[model samples]
Target chain A: MIRGIKLGLLVVCLAMAWGFPAQPAGANSDMPKPAARWVTADHSKFEALKQDFKSGPEVTKACLSCHNEAAGQVMKTIHWTWLSPDAPPEAKLGKGGLVVNNFCIAMPSNEPRCTSCHAGYGWKDKNFDFAKQENVDCLVCHEQTGTYKKFPAGAGNPASEPKKMGPETFLPPEWNKVAQSVARPSRDNCGTCHFYGGGGDMVKHGDLDSSMKNPDRNLDVHMDAKGANFACTRCHTTIAHKISGRAYKTPAAATRISLLKDDQISRITCESCHSETPHKVDVKLNDHTDKVACQTCHIPEFARKLPTKMRWDWATAGQRDAEGKPIKKKGPLGPPSYDGMKGDFTWQKDVRPVYQWFNGSITNVMAYTKIDPSQPVTLAKIDGDPGDANSRIYPFKLHTGRQPYDKSNNTMVVPKLFGPPGSGAYWSDYDWNKAISAGMAYVDLPYSGQYDFVETRYFFQTSHMVAPKDKAVSCQECHTVDSRLKGISGVYMPGRDYNRPLNYLGWGIAAAALLGVGLHGLGRAVARRKNGNHDHQA
Target chain B: MNGNGNGNKPLYLYTRFERFWHWAQAVLIIVLAVTGLEIHGSYTWLGFKRAVEVHNFCAWTWLVLYAFVLFWMATTGEWRQYIPTTKRLIDVALYYMVGIFQGKPHPVPKSERDKHNPLQRMTYLSISLILIPAQMATGFLYYFYNSWALWGWGAKLTLSTVAFIHTAGMFGFLAFLVVHVYMTTTGHTLTCHLKAMCTGWEEVGVPPKS
Candidate 1:
């Protein structure tokens, strides 16, 4: 019996020691690849493409002849108007005209340089008309050729002349060739402006960068070149030239419109393709969708390929080299951490996104809006609460910075940063007073004599570059001690911080059991021997 | 009684139902402990996704089986065997602590009417009355977490507290399991208790006190 029992114990010990090997979870199913990149039609054969367009307006005229209503459709979008119809009448002028950002502050004073990213042409000042159809640049988003270039101080027009743009001789794009080579928007077309947001690459939106042009499956499974090869329109789902989703400004919730409702259909959400119950196999994961956004898990970290700007301090600007040129200092990551043209900046790569309960409503800071100088202004506030049914735990990139603001008026100020010499620009003259004064005069706003760089923070919603399911964040990532959800409040998670008294009780019981077992076994052995009972086990 | 190869008789101390309940409970407890510890972040060998599934399934199985066993024990009058008495309880404690090492006989006798010793009876009673019920209640609360807002007390209770109670219960179960396995080897033969659990019979001797 003893030998049998020992053998059984040995077998059990050996089996346990070998351990149960874990099977890898998640499927590697692929979505159907997109069609080849070649355009179906040759636009150069058309008579409209035969002429040498002298300016952007002449190119727009040729485009309007065939696609007459295309300019009208573009005008209605926030990309053109820069103002949402939902905004109050008091501040509905336009995002470019009134909205103040923490990065480079307001845009009113620096339209020539700022409008380089705008879809329309010649928005240099308040005098620029929002109703002009000819000013719309059709080739910006549709140009099939990669030669469409928008230079600084040209408003929205390509540099057609060999003009000197701050130390570089800028060559203009061939309008005749570019106008004839128009095709459907590609990654290059969208990335021209979006990738270089906040004046440089990977500065404004942490999740977006030039690396997304031909990403691998490891970088972004959805847009992988070797896999899905999805275009921007694949998810954005544009209709009548109006892109479905809006960033910087997002809706509180996706207002559904179908046979189920009569409300006007709006932007596309993650639920549009994934469906409300995304996790078909796991019902528990589906239940989590109500209170957790898909991006929170699927996209574990943002800025995976490159370092993104985390913070900037304009207070440290105006540093000059020995030759009196703007000083530039490179960080360990190869990006300029300190530039005399801007200020001090901090950058990070593979950053874990901050989680918050956001309902998607954003409150943007406008130029004329009053601000308390005592605290860092929230350039864009993500509004939501834990109790709100519409709210979900979403991932965000919080960019903290400092920018020039009107000390006397308690409002954010616009500074001229780029221009020719003697232009009263900060970069040209290094005079904050003159640059701000010129900027305020252009926007028809009063500028106080006293100016200072105030601290500010902007919140960016992370919505793209999703990885594969297997690459998604594991459960133990956020469910352990000192976990990712450490800063998040009002939610109870197991193994990551527990209640105190209950923990003590658990240990106490185990200790008592050990003592009881040892004493009982010893007493039983002693009592049996004292009774002259030679009977023994084992 | 039946005569063994060693000339010692084996008495039918446990019924088939009792033996079945004991073995079933032991298997269920072992399954629960392995999966439960994995769920508590002890190790990630099973992977959290699979561990949760196994733990929840075994918990339900154990709960349902225990309910059925309780009914069977009550109807068969076997529940009376677990009732504790002060008579010879101190003697049994002393016998285990010191008397057994000095070659003294066991204070209590093993019979059809009373198979468990006084210490075993009290321990089993505590486990069944206090520990098992507490764990079951906490486990039930955890399972129905979504419906917490519907009940007044449940609404006031935080999920962390519920999780804490459940974890505490798991530890108690672990301690009980360790002692139970060790005690099984202390019978007249090394495998005597295990054999009785399977065959419904145990080797016995005349009680010295009797």
Candidate 2:
């Protein structure tokens, strides 16, 4: 029994071991690997062939033999500056002198990766030293993999010079002397990087993932077919041997330049081949064109996101009560006072005061102006004792020479009006009630105007605010429209003015009517069948 | 099981105009709901632009039908049936809330004089008199925004408020549709009400008055 149990236990252990297995030994093992090397037509063989052709200058005899003046133009382009000895030290470091790319991982700046796009030799740091400057180096543009001279054309030895002419450069004895020139960078080559996963911070306007999946990825910016027949440099002419925006000066100018202007030609934009006018605005066909920007109203964001609500606030406008006190407390009283004066009262700074008023019930009436101290003041009203024989009138006129109300001073002036006798009524030209009414009306006009503009602009300004006249809108504009005033009760919209009960009642009635008619018809049908059967029996 | 289905005399009073309006309104409502949902991006069976066109067409059709229905109901004295009743209304409410769910029969009986259940009368009355009209008004306000501006009323009225009202109405309609669908399923065999809607004939049976 012990022996049998041991065998069964061993079998179970094997099953569990196989099911929940350990990682393979090869997975974690590490070993030194051979360095990678490129094998192709030997550079020595090509050099030897060139030595026998000591018939003319190297550039003239070897490169211009086919490229002609085209080779000379390429030398002046920004692409060539990648290897220029005079290029800024930071430019050689790639993006902003931070990240280094793997393609040009070594061999200074003149490696295969750098020379692949640059068209020169021995470019390291700021040193662009080239011996054979005019060698068209056909493999760079045509891709290193496929070449006619290296293939069907005499089956050139694979061990020979790896730089073989492409089909475009392959010339017959008669066509050998013909010259071809390419002035611009190819969109396809630019798209290779400008597309979804294109390296670097270029084209950072949202992810281009969906655009890359588009079948026309290989096409030019205009959505036209890019044949393998043309070279990238044909249209992307060299401007001081550098990419476009590297030459920008100001930060603002740099942003505009590097971000690709809407109508300008760039490797990533459709304006490269198509007309700069992206949209044909037939005003008759689309009446909305007068108010809409193509990018502003029709871009991807508009179709996806739209504002659904309007926001407004009115309580922040320094509301006051009938007692000439600021309404600031929660209830129908002004904010609590601590120093024999009202709470911290603040009125709108922009308001121009045209009138003022005071009470005439007390003999020692004092009024203080908060804004100005230098201006001479007049007593508009004063308190008086009733039935006193020596009573005096409350209203008092200011000296003729006193300065008019001066708004420049930031101090308050208190005007004291006192009399030992009784007085009944007091009056002055400064009417606070009338001034407040007028100011309220004026303020409401702009408020209502802004509200109306927001309503109308809602349809078009999906992501914008209705700015208050000249200033941008603030949160308080929409949130605090009806808040507590200083101390008195203020009437907003009163008495069921905006109530929606009628809406509910209307819906209820209509639905009831539909149900009634439907059921009544059914009832009649049943009743008619019963009545007809009874009549037939009779 | 006797010769006739009910004891009342046949009214034969439902005019051809009323029936036409009723059927057309029902069809247009279904079309509108389906097309409106498509516009909301719920489904893409009908492309967005095409769905919008259909929705607009149905909206106009419903508006025209509503006018005719209103005129017919007003002049023919048919609108009287929708007037509210206080007697036995609580019984009708209880029948829907608890009795119906318990498989107990409805308290209200179908007859030539009193066709609608009390709950049906109240709900339909609210929808027809309140919600539908408000939705129509708000919809028109939105559609004629330019005209409103030209008339100078646009300065006072906000389109966002109108949109809020319209969206609120849409929710009301959706709620009504949910109840209607559930009630339809509650009929005998689960499809009895659906068949009646399609053929204008419903099977009648005695309902217990509890």
Candidate 3:
């Protein structure tokens, strides 16, 4: 019997060993060996000859040997005329030629960095030959060859006999046709340059990284997974060579800018793919049509700049001591002072000051001004009151305040005068009636004297008094206005913060119970063991 | 070990109402968890939206049942069973920590009047009265945030803060689930306690001497 048991055990052990492998003791299993290196044929002699051959002349000869007629067509491309002797008069950067980028070290028009994206040869010199069809920089589209690694190795010999170019001289016809079909300029391609992560100057409206990772990020019609897969060119085909005049200025303009228009200037729109109904119920555009765009209200955080430094203290505003005297002295309506000291000053240059003001309980004023006294003053203000009828009008002011002072002594400063209190200088106020009467224009604060044409920038800071903690979206908001389909009736709507404590308590109870049961079971096991030991001794 | 010994009026420990509530809650919670996980795409035990709908329904039922149980306990004076006490608590603790492993007797006896061991009372009291109620409150707060806003609450509260509270509750639930599963395996014969929950009868053991 003992021998049989031993044999059976041996068989089981052998089976286990075969099923699961154990590496040899002390053996290292994970090191990777180096790959073999390759040696290349020597071409040192060709390198010397390369210096003597004029690359431009050689490239021209090569082009003429194959693409005689197509070379003329390629010359008409903007790539051929990239560099010009004279700068365009209409460029925004003024006569020095338009600098498309400012992040790079400022370069003149002749620099290679700028000209690389432009089309032309020997662009650094003013003698750029616009008529040269041979130097039309063909590698932009025909980028298969001339890649950094493949160059020189792939550069055909200058003296080699040229082969006749056929239809193959262009890209594969199928791929070329497909590329044309999907060729509208898309934000994706543009996004390579325009998106926030790409180091471009475009607006970073939504955080792309977080939005992409967010499981619940909203996907509108324009951003539908299927719709986004299509190339941008499938829609935006207008002004193909130059994108300058093709951008949409308004929501209405976007609808009109399609590829199907009689003017052949049409472009695709989001409405093409998405369901037309934006909301659960279609909202009709009445008088508010011009005032709002689908993107204006729905586009998350469109107008939200980072919260300006919070300065207005609502709790302290209009606060008084027991004696009824103002607890804190009020300063002038411009930049806030760090030390609470107010001083009279004059502008030394032309200045345009922007201001933000609240028409509600708290009024905050901020201004930027030129340091010179002789400059004209222009003012802009963003104004609104939460409870007023005309609460959202922002206005611009282009006049100087009339507060006079002794320029020589800089003393006996007359009380600072603002534009007439009801004039179009103040942006917002609590009186809704007055705001409407003023044609929703900004009015100047009241002041009594005349000053120079000094421009001061001001911003009115308003307090968002509504706290987020106390608000919740109720079921009724979705269900009441419509049918029962909107209501989630049987759902266990646990309070927002309740699950954690409940879960914690559940775990605590379970742990305590486990401890109790485990101890009891162990006790029983020990008792059995003791009994067995007693039996064995007997 | 005769039939006569078994006839000793099968000492009733848990009240009928208490047992009913316990079993009901257990069933509801299990259903909630299974369906909840399904809704989250953690598994495909059930279809997606269907699982979500079922989970929500069960959760509501559980909440309602808990409320009724709370009312019954309060009215019938049965809540006294969960009142925590220090008596024999240290002995119970030592039994769990050292004595039980040495084959020593249980410090607290299972009795007709005071059914819970000292540790049991504390655990049940905290879970039933404190944690569950807190979870419910927070969950409700999240569900009705917009309504709260309409009632001038949004003017004060942020949605992000509410979302944080909800997420914290989910973590707590997960922690509880882990401990619950581990404890279920530690009964006499391993499956003894589980069988008792199913049949509503625990095979009483002999009282240990002090």
Arrange candidates, best lDDT first. Answer: 1, 3, 2
Q: What does each candidate score in C-alpha RMSD?
A: 9.5, 29.3, 23.8
Each model's lDDT: 0.77, 0.36, 0.37
DockQ (0 to 1) for model 1: 0.31
Query: Which lDDT tens digits does candidate 3 get at residues B1-210?
Result: 112243324444455666777788777767766765443333555554356467667767879988888799889787888899999999988876765455444566455566677887987787787767766765566545546646888557754455455444544555555555554454323564555555556554433222
Per-residue lDDT of candidate 2, residues A425-467 (tens digit)? 0011123223222222322211111110000000111111111
- Candidate 2 Cα lDDT to native: 0.36
Ten-residue segment with the worst summed lDDT in candidate 2 chain B? B1-10
The numbered model that scores best in lDDT is 1
Per-model DockQ:
0.31, 0.05, 0.06
Model 3 TM-score (B-chain only): 0.76
Please state the Cα-based DockQ of model 3 relative to the true two-chain complex: 0.06
